[model samples]
Target: MELAIVGLGRMGGNMVKRLLRDGHRVVAYNRSPEPVREAEAAGAIGAYSLEEVVERLSSPRVVWLMVPAGEPTEQMVERFAALLGSGDILIDGGNSYWKDSVRRAEWLRERGIQFL
Candidate 1:
């Protein structure tokens, strides 16, 4: 599957690498340019912005977030929700509280975006 991963920290970056190894198309983005450049060198497409990430993916886009918990994750989800269309999926791989995750899932679901 084609996926866009935001926040190229250790976990996220490794996810991109593993996905590439499995022959999946990955678009990687980071707040810092270095991680993104590194991911690009490792065969992942580099996206500088959330809009670019969305633009790079095909329909029924899948975007994974690896940002920090609480405010950071919330902000990223909100930003991606605005960019992604109905039928798109957002996966959060951070250490967010379960309640927050539930809330986010419901919110995204209401907007026609799947959350996991």
Candidate 2:
């Protein structure tokens, strides 16, 4: 599947590498840009922003977010919700509380996006 990965920290970076090795088309984004470039060097596409990442893929896009919880996750999800349309999937792989996840999922659903 086509994948867009936001927040290229250790987990996100390694996931990009593994996905590429497994023959998946991966578009990687990072706040710092360095890791995005690194992932690009490793055969993944580099996306500087969420919009760019979404634009680079087809419908029913799957984006994995690997940022910290609280403000960062909230901000990212809000921004991403604007960029994503119906049927798109957003995966938060952070250490967020279950309640936050439930809330986020409902929020995304209200905006016609899917959360996992």
Q: Tell me the TM-score of each prediction against the true structure.
A: 0.97, 0.97
Off by over 4 Å in 2: none
Clash counts per candidate, in order, are 0, 0
Q: For residues 1-116, write the lDDT of model 2, one tens digit per residue.
A: 79898988888889999999999999999988889889989999989877899999888899899999988998999999999999999999898899999999999999889999
RMSD of each: 0.7, 0.8
* Model 1 pairs whose backbones collide: none
The CA root-mean-square deviation of candidate 2, after full C-alpha superposition on the true structure, stands at 0.8
Identify the runs in model 1 with alpha carbons over 4 angstroms from their true place.
none
Tens-place lDDT digits, model 1, residues 1-116: 89999999989999999999999999999998999999999999999988899999999999999999999999999998899889999999999999999999999998999999
lDDT for each candidate structure: 0.94, 0.91
Model 1: weakest 10-residue lDDT segment is 77-86
lDDT of 1: 0.94
